[model samples]
Target chain A: MSVTVIIAILVVAFLAGMDGILDEWEFQQPLVACTLIGWLLGDVTTGVLFGGSLQMITIGWMNIGAAVAPDTALAAVGAAIWVCGPAHLTVAEGLAIAIPLALIGQGLTVIVRRLVVKLVHYAERSVRQGNLNVITRVHLLSLTLQGLRVVIPTALILLVPTTLMQTFKAGLPHNVVMGLAVAGGLLAVVGYAIVVNMMATKWLWPFFILGVVLAAITALNMIALGLIGLALAIIYVQLQSQTRPPSGPDDEMDELDRELEDL
Target chain B: MTSANNQMPKTLTRPDLFRLFWRSSFEQGSWNYERMQNLGFVYVMMPAIKRLYDTPEDQRAAVLRHLGFFNTMPYMQSTITGVVANMEVQRANGSQLDDQAINNVKVGMMGPLAGVGDPIWWGTFRPVLAAFAAGLAQGKASLIGPLLFFFGWNIARLTFRWQSQKVGYSLGVTITTKTGNLLPKLTQGASILGMFVMGAVIPRWTSIEMPTVIARVHAHDQLEQLTLQNVCDRILPGLVPVLLTLICLWLIRKRVNPIWLMLGILVLSIFGYSIGLLGVK
Candidate 1:
């Protein structure tokens, strides 16, 4: 990789790191994250293809309440490097690598979040001291740590020279490679099931069934279905609200639809 | 209520609002299980709090007030931040308000705003555009996917956040009266759409197939073998994937750890593929 490529990846990684925590910019989403890396690697097209596929597999991932979801940022960058770099792996192969990367990112995220507790403790002191500058610095430092979480791992991955990556790719058996491809496809099932588990209510099972049946029979596509969903959702909301009993209004739930998306 | 002009003793300048808007993006910087987004919320309010409360005691109290537990979607955060900042100004100016009122606003807003934001952003708009973009990328228009998604999502989201802050600030407490009817309906509609989209994708994203032949049968003109997956497709186009998903759901319900389940699926895939029972479509 050229210095330009490596530096670009680091900068993107740094931004993604911060964005991952903020959950804004969505620089962490595979679609965007991988594309940025792909663009830097001079293969914006492949980066996008990989990112989009990867995004579907991770579509249901989210951080609900306090639980951290698997890290899409790590999955995107690591998988992008493998797919777009010297290895030139297929999207399925890149996705296979994303599963473990997600886990690793999750663990690292937990640790980083925990480590920032110390910063919070220090922030209390700055608050007491009436030192606005210190208060600002503490927050900035915490943001830096978040950025480094993605950058450090990404930098390390790029440091592996091209020949090593080529040799690494050459060594894997064809069957093993095929198995990983199969694994990647099935992993997507896991992702969807996870979403179903969180979002599906007993009353909502019909909707799930409805979607499956329609998809099975028609080529009407997701966009068309999405439009139908929008119409039905609007209608359902109006009807349900009108029918609902006028009781004291507090639907406090540690939502039974509990699932974590970001690491 | 926002201390906008009439009272005019002080104001949150455009620079301060800009700073706060950008700074508020860091609300999850130190997310901890204990307090969630509490510290970040305090961090965001610091500028406004410091500007409003000149006395050290009042400043420290203001900071302490905001450090309580807070959690909400980042998109909807500026609304609460703006409202609280406005209310905090009122309190600083000797309005007959207590910290509890600000706390009430924060707590009250987090739930409904989140209830609204998640379904729309996470569930509906995001999935719709992303899946569309992903589909495009998978086809020949690969470059368009990420560019459309990034620019499209950020444009809507950034504008909404900025506008929401301004609206929330301008309306003050009355923001509640206007939004009470709107939020619940928007949330319900979005969630419904989200659920529907999720359903549509089940057949597309989830993959399951049975490669083994279940039986041999005489066809109209030739000998034929029936595959298990063929039977499933005849019965239901996505039965295998749906069944697989349900089984995974049951495993999750049974408290089988998700990581272990993921590993199990990993092993199952490798074994199935090695034995010629599973392959990518």
Candidate 2:
């Protein structure tokens, strides 16, 4: 890769890292991160394709309550580099690499979050001393560390000789490649399962079954299926509201819903 | 509860509210396990605290109050920030709301909001939307897929943050009493949508196919062929995908690390493919 391209990839990695913790702009998600990296590498197709596949695999990886899911920033950016850069790996190989990276990234994230405790303490002390700028400075500095978490790994990965990656790819057995692809195909199941674990209730299983059966039997694209889902969700909510008696005046959830509706 | 400071601005100005909204987006910038967004909360509240509390002691107290443990879904923190901002304004205007009262509201709201927000945004909305966009990306090899997700998510998120903050501010102390069935109801609605989409994506997105010929039968003087994949499709088109999803769900419920599950899947796929029990067309 050219110097400019390498610099751009690092920049993308940095953004992905910052967004990993921030989780605000979603630059960490493979869909965006890979696409940007791929665009930087001059192969948008491979980048996007890898991103699309990786997105499904990581879709259900969520931070619910206090539990942190695996890290996507490093996984997405690192995988995209291999697939879209001089490594010339296939998307499936890229995915195979991404999974382990995600695990490692998850570990890194916990460590970083732990270390940031000291920074928070420092910020607290600064506040006690009445220096408000330390709050912003410490926060921004911590965010930069998050960006580096991915960038440093990515920089190291880029430092690996491109020919070595080619040699590694060439040495893989055909069955291994095929198996990796098969694994890739089946990997999205894990993400789906996580979502199911989170959202599934006895009452909700039927919608899932209905969705499966409909998609299996019909030629409906995802957009069409999604529209049907939206319609059904709205219908179900409406019927539910009509049948269920309002809880007494303390029903804050209903008020919150009404508040949401006004928005 | 009358105060001596009738001269102080009793409410945050529009500029102050905007500053709060803008800063709220970075609420997790300093996330740490020790306090879990305590500093982030302080960071977000700094602008409002500066605007409302003129005295050094009151400002110090306000900062100290928010520095306590505070964590929730990142997006949902906006509502808490709004409510807290309102309380700060009242306290500054001579209301009897103590630091404990402020902390009480923070603790009280974070749990419920996190419960609702995590599933709605992270669980339901994001997965559902990303599934669709990924499909588009893979099916068409188009830039629109990622673009759609990027814009779609941010638009909804930004709007939610803005509106929720406003509503929380306007509701103020009333929000404490306003809690009701909305939690289960919204959660149920999101679950319904989420489950349905998940089911749909299994068949549409997951690509497990058993292309290996499991058996061959010749009953009518002519050769007959049967593939395990064909049998599976005859039974149910997405049976393998569904079964795999269920197994993963079970294992996840059993507390197996997802990384291990993924590594297991890799091994299983290689083995299955090598043994001709699984194949890709």
Candidate 3:
């Protein structure tokens, strides 16, 4: 690859790493990051082709509380680099490369997050001293460490000969690769599980069941279902609120209890 | 600190609000296992902290006070930041709201907001838009898929981040005063809608089609077996995914660590595939 392309990859990787944590722009996500990498490599087509599918698989992976999900930034960028750049693998093979990389990326994120805790202590120190600049710099520095979490690994991977990966791909067994694909499909359940678990309440089980049945049985579009849901929610909220007596702290607390099942 | 004289020392300028809004986007950057996003939370409110506390000790206390455990839905945090900023301003004006109360509000709002926000934004909004975008890419508009998702999600969310803060600031203390149980009612409303959308879409995203069939059965010509998917559809369409989701729900209620459950799903999938019980759609 050209030096400028390498620089572009590094720059994008750094931003993606930081964005992974920020989650503001979501530049770290496959759809955006891979597209950018592909554009940089003059292979925007393949970059997007794989990025689209990867986005669906990793869409639900997020940091809920202190637990970090798989690192989308690292996996997305790393897979894109391999697929769009030297290795030039097919989208399916690129996905196989990307999926396992998610586990590695998850490890890196947890470690980086732990390492950043020391910086948080420093930030605390800076706060005690009443130095806003120092504290802000520390926070940004912590963010940079996260950036390097992806950049350094990506640079190291780039150092290896692309031919080696090609050879490695050739040697990989079909079942194992197929297994990874199946793993990707199954991983969707985890994402849905977490969401369902969050939204699942004793009174709400019927709604969950209703959603599944509608999706399975009918050819209704997503927007149509969303509209149906909006209608159901409005009707329920209106009827329920009207039936309730004057609002009290106890009543609010009970509603809030139903709000937090896991908590 | 009580709101002495019922007036603030200073009003935040537009630039300050703009700066705070921008900074709030990185509110999870310094996330740590011990205190979660506490430092990032403090960092985002630095503008407000600096504006409110002129004395070094006051500023120090202000910063340190926010450096406790804080986590919330990323996009929805702007409201908290805005409300907290206003409270800090009130505190600086010498309000009765002490550090403990401020922290209490911060701590209290996050969970309920997280409960409401996680499902609405991350759970529903994201998956719906993203799946569509991904679907578009799988179709003729491959490039447009990423473009649409990138622009659609970012524009929608960034606007939300900006606007919610404005709404929070405008509503400010009135949230506790003017509206009794309004937040809860809103939470109830939001969650219901969330469940509705979730109901319609969960089955579609969740794939648990059964390709397995009875083995060693003789029928039409050689060996024939009942199609499990057909049977499932006859009983209830999308039964497998729904049942699978419920099983996951049961496991989660049983206090299974989510990460372990995720790994378990992976292992189960591998085993299921190897044993010819599960196949990828």
Candidate 4:
């Protein structure tokens, strides 16, 4: 890869890490990470496209409280950078490497968070002393640490011997690779099941099944599919609202609907 | 009025603006203190801090501190624009810029804008681009795919930054009046677009086909032949993909982790390939 491209990738990784630490929701997700990495690697479009595909597969995935989803930021960013970078790997191949990279990324995040806790204490002292400069420095320090989390790993991956890497990849039997792909597909289904169970209501199952069927059969685009699904969801919500006993205020009902809508 | 009114105006320069923009853009990645300092120093301050020597120390410090917090590029742009506008109005009205107010505005807007902008920019837009690129990858249009990806994303990013800054400036008077209800509607629209592209692209990009078996029935003096496709059509048309999907569903319902599931599938595929159970052409 060109030195400029490598620098760009490193910058993107650093930014992605910052996004995660800042809790900029989308930044931590694959969409932005992949796009930025892709753009820097001279293929923004592919980066965005791959990022989006991975986004859907992990649509219902979230890091609620302590439960960590696969580190999509790493997967998306790493995949794009590797595929669109000097590596020139196909999306599938890039993803094959990227997925494991995401798991490793998650480990890095855990370590960063643990380290950040100590910094927060330092910030508390700065705040008590009325040292706004120190407080600001502490914030900067935290963000830098987060950026390093991504930069260090990505640099290492890029720096590794390509021939050695190829041999390592080749050493895995064909069955193993295919089996992993199948397993990934299956796990995606499991992720969907979690969402389905969370949104359980007798009437919605039909719509859910209908969605699966439609997705399986017709070659309708996601936009068309989403509109259909959204329309159905809205109708279902309205009907359910009407049939229910009037036991609450309008605001309360709205809140309940909003909560349900989120699911 | 007697002493404060006689103070010289704090003249802002181009470098001040550049510093602000640079800081905002670099801060886009700040998740913690270390990242903020490193990125802030390298990407933000290093470019503009030298210019600060010509300005008043307090103003310089204020500007530096303002750029310190966690921010995304667009969010940072919007927040900085908002603060600048606020300062301009204060200057015009014969009052010094309220440091707390500027900080409040910066901190206040970053969260919501980041919340909305991040997902819309990354989750929705990027994926649509990836879907197209995946098709290109399949076609071996290698260079074209990546080029298209970059063009689409930068256009979106730059547009968002400009639009957000405009909104921040124009609506500074009653910023709260700007509602985010519009976001969900926009996201809904984008989601539809995103999914459509994914559906069209995934099959082409990924290996999702299955092998089929055929059985024939023959009479004493007659023989019959049937193709795998014909047999499949007879017993539930388009069964293979559906069967694959259903199998995925079954595995999902069992609450297995994706990593383990992936490992399982890889093993199964290799086994099937070796045994010739899954015919590989």
Candidate 5:
């Protein structure tokens, strides 16, 4: 890789790392991260394809409450570098590398969050000294640490020679390559399951079943299916509101009860 | 400490609210296992605290008041910030609310908001949008998919954050009481769409091809070959994918770690391929 391209990749890695925790700009998402890395490497097509496939697998990997999901930032950057760079690995190999990297990234993220407690303590001391500026400084510093989390690993990955990576790819058995491709095709199921588990309830099964049945027909594309889903959701909610009387605080309790029952 | 009665009514101008909105984006910058977003929350509230308090003692107290544990869905915390900003304004202007009262409000609102916010924003809306974007990108090989998702999500997110902060500020405490039912309703609607789309996506996105030949049949004196996929299709199309998803969901419910699950899938797929039970599409 050229010096300028390497710098650009590091920058992308930093942003992805920071956004991993910020969850604000979503730069860490594979769709955006891989696409940027792809563009930087002069292979937009492979980058985007890799990104979209990775996005599907990582779609349900979300941080809900305090439970952080596996890291997509490292997965995307690392895998995109291997797949789109001089190594020229296939998407299947990229998938294999990305999954394990996600686990490593998740571990690093947890460690970083734990270490940030020290920084928070510094902010606390600063608060005691009545210097409010230190609080912002501490917070930004912690964010920088997050950005470095991805950048450090990416830098390490980039240090490996391209020929070594090609040799590594060449050494893989044929069955293993075929197996990884099969795994690649099957991996999205895990993501789908997580998403379905998050939203599934007794009342909503029909919609899911309908979606599955409708999706079997080739006529319905994603856009058409999305519109159908949206319409049904709106209509269902509307009918529900109209049928139910105006709810007071008592009804709020009943709503909670219903929500619990649904769960 | 009781010298605030001489001060006139303190209000947060648009610029102040704007600052809060901008700063709220970094709410999780200092997320820690202990006290979770405490420092970050303090950071976001600094602008409001600086603008509302005059006395150093009061500013210190205000800063200390928010130093306790605070965490929630990062985006939804904007509403809490707005409501707290309103309370701070009132307290600065000599409202009888104690420090404990403000912390109570923060604690009271975080859980419920996190509950609603996670399922809607994190679970439902984002995955749905990503599925469409990925489908566009993967199928058509278009650049618009990532750009569409990046811009689409942020636009909706920023608009929600800005508008909800303003509304929460304006509505203040009443929002908690009034929104008791509304949040669940919104979640319900979003989940409905989420479920439907996920169902459709499962059949389309997950590619489980069991092309291994399992049987031979004789019909009308002609030999016929039957693959596992053929039998599966005869029973139900997309059967393997649906079953695999259900098994994973069941395992997840049983508290199986997802990382293990992915690794297991990897091993199983490799084994299946070696045995000629699974094939690449």
Candidate 6:
């Protein structure tokens, strides 16, 4: 890639990473990131295809509080750039590459978080010393550092020779690759389960079972199941509200006021 | 109170603004003006600003006016408005809005914003675009697929950001009005369309093949026309992939670390590949 292309790729990566840090929706997703990378590499088709598959596999993935999900954006984008570039690798092959890349990206994120903590502490000290300029510098430094964490790895992957990648691919055993695929598929179910478990309500279990059955029958995808889930959630909330007995007049009025207040 | 007299009221530097933007942007999970003021850059700058120049009441008010609209995060317009209101009250009291106070507002806003934003953008908007992109990718017009994907996502992001800020500043009401409710319906429709495209892409994209197996329907009737698709579809239509996903789900429920799951997959894939059970081309 030319310097301009490289710069463009890094800029996209920065924006994508920033989106992730900000926890924006689809922009932080692997599907979007890979597609952007693919567009940059001049093979949006392969990129979108691979990205969509990865997105489905990781659809229910999330980062709750301190827990972090695998960095799918890095995996999808890295693999897309690798496969859809001059290498001309197939989508399946790109997917295989994405698995490990995602893992590595997660590790890199953990390290970045650890490093950022120190910077945050320094920023706190700057605040105490009444140095707003230094504090601002530190905050910018953290964002830049986070961006670099993604950009550096991506640059290295992009710069690597095709022959090396080919050799790595050649050395892998066939059954192991198959097993990994099987394993990858299985992990997706777990991802879905985690989401379901988080939103665990008795009535919602039907939707979960329905999701499993629909998925088994190949009659529905996550989106369909999610819609059904949403409907059931609304119904459940409505029923719960209606069935609850009202307390005495004053208490009931207070409860009613609180409910109205929340709205 | 004297500390309030120390700082300057200059417009923020570019880098400070960038940091402030990002800090506030990340807090999109909940928007409040108070939280925006205490964001990493803004929080740090307040005390320093007091030390550097004497910030008059109007200057403080002016600095706060724009800060109230600084919602870099999508779907957080309502909470940002609340924060802005809180900041206006606190600044008027002559109390320095510190980092902790800013973070407290952030912590308050994130949960509600996340509750609202996640479903709207992640569960709804994303799947809609993915459907179109997936359809395009599967067709011969693959190159256009990504372009379409970017166009849809950027359009949403830019439009949402602009609208959210405007709503926060002008309307000063929750942005999740009647319009927000329409997105899930749209998303559901798009998801159904995407699923159909995905069905076609499965066999086309993957190297799924099965060994020739013999089936005897009658005495002397041996059949050897079975392929992977036949086995996969016959078992449960999409059993192979679904079964694979279930196994992973089981492990995840068991609380096995994802790293271990990945490692296990890598090792198993190599073994399966070597044993000729799984084929890759």
- Give the poorly placed runs of model 5, Cα more than 4 Å off: A242-263, B1-8, B214-226
Candidates arranged by DockQ, highest first: 2, 5, 1, 3, 6, 4
- Identify the CAPRI category of the predicted complex in candidate 2: medium
Residue-level lDDT for A184 in candidate 2: 91
Best by lDDT: 5
Candidate 3 docks with a DockQ of 0.43
Lowest lDDT block of 10, candidate 1 chain B:
B1-10
The worst-scoring run of ten residues by lDDT in candidate 4 chain A lies at: A185-194
Listed in order, the DockQ scores are 0.47, 0.73, 0.43, 0.15, 0.69, 0.22
C-alpha TM-score for every candidate: 0.89, 0.94, 0.83, 0.59, 0.94, 0.67
Q: Candidate 4 residues A93-154, lDDT tens each?
A: 66567668778887887777667656755654554454445544665776788778888888
Model 2 per-residue lDDT tens digits across residues A6-51: 8988999999989889999999999999999999999999888889
The chain A TM-scores for the candidates, taken one by one, are 0.88, 0.91, 0.83, 0.76, 0.92, 0.81
Question: Positional deviation of A15 in candidate 5, in angstroms?
Answer: 0.3
Which 10-residue window of candidate 6 chain B scores lowest in summed lDDT?
B29-38
Model 3 DockQ class: acceptable
lDDT tens per residue, model 6, A62-103: 665455677775776687787678776656566667777777
**Could you tell which candidate, 4 or 5, scores higher by lDDT?**
5
lDDT at position A99, candidate 2? 90
Cα lDDT, model 3, residue B166:
87
lDDT of 1: 0.78
**Which lDDT tens digits does candidate 6 get at residues B1-281?**
55445644233344533332344444422212233322342442343244323545443433332332232224453345434434533554465765456545545555556555654455444544554465466456465655666677767665665444444433322334523544444433333323332332232222333343334333356544655556666765445644554465577668877556656655665565565555543
Better candidate by DockQ, 3 or 4: 3
lDDT, model 3, position A1: 84
Model 2 reaches what TM-score against the true structure? 0.94
Chain A, candidate 5, TM-score of 0.92
